[model samples]
Target: MIKEIAILVYPGCMGMEVFALTDLVLMANHLAKNMHPGKFSALRVKLVTLRPNPVAIAGGFKVAAQRLRGKPDLIVVPGLEVSRFGEWDERFARLGQELKAIRRFHGQGTELASVCIGSFVLAEAGVLQGRRAATAWPFVSEFQDRYPDVQIEKDAVILSDGGVTTTGAVSSVMDLGLHLIRESMGSAVARAVSKLALIDGGRVSQRAYVDTALIPQNRAPFSTQVNRWLAQRLSETYNLCALADAFNVTSRTVLRRYRQETCMTPLQWLQKARIEKAKHLLELSSMSVAEVVVAVGYHDLATFSRLFARETGQTPGHYKRLFQGKRVATFPRG
Candidate 1:
């Protein structure tokens, strides 16, 4: 059974990604303690870092490391924002040494995991070769370009290729940890941990946003045209073929271009745009559902309702009620 774990921290790391892993692990530990006292002890966790001080992240957040005496059973490396202006910062060189040392510990049979962009660190170490991995969708192309040997699956939430696990994004780290708990202990334990953490395992897959296929390289022209067209004809009925014809392209080409640029097909994009318009009308205006549907270019109320529910995970009526409730809560009666 895996007991000890460590989470690597460094400057430029995403605060939320690190917390997702630690939160899930801590929840699993808590559930273990509640289920059987003294039977299965909580996993040991250490925040490992290069320096003996706290490191600053992108959004002005800093995290301190907890010193470790020995190698842990698992080590989690959270993602960091890459600087596009040039090569990785010099601070990453020191982090590289820390990663190498952690790998040496992993070579002794300790399992390794990474969250979102943290896969880059693992790729630099040359450990992910021939391994299937996943990272944030936006970085998928860059990651593949940098590490061609690694089989990076774009659709996976949490990929485990021979004990080197990687999650797609920050939120997916929570899913990854729950998966680890299930593997180490049992499904029962994982379910209990999910309950305590208030996470739905089923929703984990739906939240993933990466796509690995070769997408269109340029999107400015397409996005601009689409936005203008969408804005002017909010009440007009639109179709994929019509939009494609307007752009003088085939439907398939339009679909591919849209997917590459926005991570959504034309239809999905239309629905999202419609939903946003509907939300504004519901919140800022006194438009009813029927009027909102017409305003947002939808003729069928049923279709609009279904699409809205799928997009937001709540019925339009329920969303309206919740939004209204929040507004009312903010402005109480005198």
Candidate 2:
């Protein structure tokens, strides 16, 4: 089956995911033709616009887009490069035609999809209204404010709900590509594409990319103070009694309120804060895994490793390597 995909391009669309996803689908086409000619065929893909003009993208690049001809099997709304926090309004003001097209296609039962903040576009078009969508972690607040009717999940890397599929972050483009292949082309072909393109298919969350310090913690005065206190004492052993005394609240009241605010108890919140700090130190400092464990209040190395893996789906060492480490330039000393 030939899956026709229309990549909706707009001014200031992020170019990386657009190019990466197109490349992946093209590779899948090649592999599918060679491997299973009788079963599957080349997927038809087109960069499309409401008008027959070159759409400006990020990095000052432009893509020649064909006038949208027909309702495609899938319409992919590409993420925009938001220079300012409140640019969603500006973006939508210019995308009146694009939004109409999306609404038209979706009403006709065509599936809708998005990459990163492209979910915002779908939300604006009302296709994602009252449906859950996977969105970029950092922009959840803005998305909620704009589209309070839509439910957003920040952790999921890829989500399919109510005939709409969405992915988190810019890098989730490959994950989305692989998911489409697995759903339409079969797992065997998806595995082949994964290996051929060297794209990791194991990513399931945006947790690794999250910065805990950035999460809004000031909804209530008590939660704000608790977060601040926790941030400073991540290296200390978790003591519920001491926390209650410091806040002048009873131990039971502390646990109940913290859980009510964060959906996590005091101990669980402490653990999360510690893991986030450990991730930060590993990415930015020259700290060894053992040192990181100690710095985060974990006494046992094996326990810390297991906890880290459970929390982020990657070992501390692997996470550090995947992020950054203190390493000198090859063949040159600093």
Candidate 3:
């Protein structure tokens, strides 16, 4: 039987999420039909929308999807562009109708999958209740607070439980689609599709891509003060006591406020800033690994290297080489 995959697009949806999954699914179907001949069945993918009208997305373009027709085998909900904290709440609030639709489709046995912040919609629909899920890292804390019963795996590239699959960040759309293809069409077809799509088949975590500095700025007053202080001195050693003294607060207060804002301890945040600076130096400067380590405020080379590897999933040297425009791998020209 041909598996039906319905990708739901919405107003302000992130186009990359929708297209990435759609293209991968289409490629999987193509590879299955051509290579395996009659050995495997193909997949039918549809761009579905709640309303039949054209919808404007994050980019400047508009898309028109078929008004969700009959229930499909799976429903992939793509995320929207959320640049502010309130945007998350606002989007879900305005999605009452869409939420109802999702619950209805799920009740009819349609499996639900979400990409990036799309998991928020699944949670709002109550489909992710009592299930393990994942979403873009920045929203993990908030998602947890809103859906207390749902388990959020912030680092996982893709997570599935009880027919509800959730993927982290926009790039995970490819990984999630490939996962589904593998499950339905077998590993062989999944590999063929991955190669055809030029995506890594082994990507299973989003930790390497997450930049702690790029995590949305914390809005709390104390967090803001701490952010300013850290920005000015990422290359210097800092102590929580000194920071608290400088800000006229107790050490515990500093820790509490920073944790509330960034979801990391003061020391962790300092390390994150230093590592981010080190990355910039590695990518742009002629400094050696040892020089780069000291430049990022680490006096001990071993400690810096270990911390860098742990946070980035790559050694300092490997990361430099990877980002220095060196060709790590070459693919046949399309």
Candidate 4:
């Protein structure tokens, strides 16, 4: 069985994702023929462009593509290179045709999938509304803020719901490609392709890869002021009375106002801030876990360790191990 796929291209799309996805699909076909010839299945692919002319992708690269050549079995939306917040709207405004194409294909019963911030397009097209989806980690808050009706699977590397699939970050294209092959050709062929390509198919969660410093801050004025207070005194002992006093409010009023603005109590917000700080020190500084605990204003090492593990889905030592010896590693100069 050969499945038809229309890989959508738009301006500012990540070139690596476009090539990597096609490369993975080609490898899957090669592996399927060798490993599962009897039940062989493959994807017949085509590149579709939103613009009539050549698509200008990221890093000053241009890709030539044709318009959609009718409905396909699946439509793949690769990630885009998003430099900052608020730029998403500007970018999406130019993707009117591409967004329409996505909506049209979905209405024609075609399965849809997006990678990284490409989920933004699907959400903009309204197909991801009322469905559980996953987007790039740093953009989750932004995504949530923009599309309040969509359910974001915060940690999953890939999520599928309502005939739509979404994957985290650009690198997740490998995982998404393997998943497509596995759905049609079976896991044996996918496993063989993964082994040949050195792509790990067992990736399940993006939890450990999260960097809280990249998470957007809550914009509410009260939440803003509260966060400012926490940042200035991250090493100070917590005292609700003092915090309330700092804001010139009663403790009960502080709690009520904080919950109203941030949906979390004052203590919870402070703990989150502390954990983010601890993660940074653990990665960049040579601080011991005990020292990190004290640096985050927690005297009890065990409690801080547990909180770190809970927030990051890995122990402080384990998280540090993942980044060991990389601090001084330099990249080749361009």
Candidate 5:
């Protein structure tokens, strides 16, 4: 279990990232206390500073670190502003020393992690060389340029190399923490923590949206025609022969071209499109399960349930319930 956690704070650090990490940690600890009772306890977290004085975060927010008496089981480095100002240099140098000390601690079973630009500090400490890591997409080029040995993967929201972990941007840090919590505790505990934090663990995979540019454009003539035809008739069920006829090709040729372009067969793509439409309706409209099934071109509830769960890792009803619950929680009570 992750009993002790330390957060590194320095001048010009991103306040939101630190707050998000701390919030998730607090949620995990709360779940631990509730689940374990007297057998185990909550996670112990502390905000520690390399300098003796309080650190001023970006936008003039000052945070005072409580003194830590011992080494933490996990140390987290939040993003810092890399500037050339005098205070910036002082804090950066102190952060470097702090990272060095944490690396030394890692040599003795402690784990080191970072969020967003914090990876730069870990890289500077020589802990990320040749390690698979990720940071904010905007910093991907700079990080690669600065540390050529580090394998920068911008597509990943979080990457772990041995004991060192790095996450992309401030929001993704919550996913990283949740992942660590799941690994340390169990899925049930992590899910409870996510519920308490009002965070949807499923959104972690949406990090792939940032890599949309990496997807190759669909330029194949048959694929283009099939996609266009399918887009117009998403609410209609079409057989493979019908699809092949529309494309003026044999079924095998159509299947091969579809798979090559979209990495999915014609029927699979159609089902995915329907599922996507169903998800949108679930989010945007108050449709019943039966109605949604028809709206998404599925007449069979069992098949829809199986496909929805397979694609989203949750049943359609469960997804609807979670989404509705989130809206109810966020709406202002009169």
Candidate 6:
């Protein structure tokens, strides 16, 4: 049996997300043929668009997507490069006819899945409305604001609810493809595909990739200075009272202002900043985990390890190993 899958393409879509998923799904089919010849022809993937028109993706390249031939068993909606925070809804709304087509396909029992910011399209189309979904962690706030009924799980790498599946961050689109393979074939096929694709199978969250400093900090001028001050000295010990004194404000005032601007208190931001710095050191420098703990202002290795694991969903060593030579992309937290 051939399981048909459609990968939706549109103008300004993330080319990498679309390309990676297409390759992974095709690789799964290739592996299946070699591993279980004559019995497995698992997936048939199509790059689809609303019409047979050329679409400009994020990069400089342009490609034509195939018009919908028939109702596919699964539809993969790929994310786009969001230049600004509020543009997703407008972009998706302009494709209202396509959104309607997606909903109709879902009505016909075609499973819907979204990658990263593509959740906005699914939500706008009403396919993911009132359901738990996952998308790029940075866009969680805006996504929730746009669709109040949709529960946004920013931490999870992938989430499946009802008939819609969503994956967090840009790279997890490949993970979502592998997940589809696991669902359609089995774990054995999925594992083989992962090995062939060189995809790490342990990515479960987007937390480790989150750069805390990049998170939006809409605050007062004085609070902005304080945030900068905190960023400069992530390795130093911090106290709310001392921070308030250094900034010539009462502790209560400091806490209130920071919370008002950043949506997080000073202490929470400080911890996040430390973790980010630690992540940087672990990835770039050949620092041991214990050295990293002390360098990040934590004295107890066990305490740092626990906090690191809790915040990033990976141990210090595991986190270091994950990005040893890889370039960590900075995702804007809108």
How many residue pairs of model 6 clash at the backbone? Answer: 0
lDDT string for model 3 (198-304, tens) is 88889777666666566566677877778778768777877778889998989988888788876888788778778888888888899999999988788998899
Worst 10 residues of 1 by lDDT: 206-215
Q: What is the lDDT of residue 199 in candidate 1?
A: 82
Q: Model 1, stretches more than 4 Å misplaced?
A: 19-27, 52-70, 81-94, 102-109, 137-155, 206-223, 238-334
The TM-scores, one per candidate, come to 0.65, 0.81, 0.85, 0.88, 0.59, 0.87
Which runs of model 6 end up more than 4 angstroms from their true locations? 325-334
Q: Candidate 1, residues 1-334: lDDT per residue as tens digits?
A: 6787788777788888777777777777777778867766676667877666777766878778865447677888888776551244454585766667666866787788888878888887777888999877667777787889999876567888887888876778778788878876678889988877778786444211222222334347886577667667767877777888888999899878777777776666666767877876766676787888888988888999888776656677766775643443366689
Model 6: per-residue lDDT, tens digit, 164-274?
Answer: 899998888878878888877778889998887788876787887887556564557866788788877788888778889988989999988888877788778778778
Query: How many pairs of residues collide in model 5?
Result: 0
Structural RMSD, model 6: 5.7
Q: Per-residue CA lDDT of candidate 2, range 1-334, in tens?
A: 3389888888878998788889988988888888888788677788888765777788788789888887789988889888766678877898888899899999999998899999998999999988999899888888888999988886889999978999999989999899888877899889999998878898888877887566545477677688788778888888888889999999999988887776777677778778888998899989898999999999999998888888887899999998985466687567
TM-score of model number 3: 0.85
Clashes of each: 0, 0, 0, 0, 0, 0
RMSD (CA, angstroms), candidate 5: 8.3
List where candidate 3 sits over 4 angstroms from the true fold.
219-233, 237-265, 326-334
Off by over 4 Å in 5: 67-69, 82-94, 107-109, 203-334
**Candidate lDDT (C-alpha), each:** 0.73, 0.85, 0.84, 0.85, 0.76, 0.83
Clashing pairs in 1: none
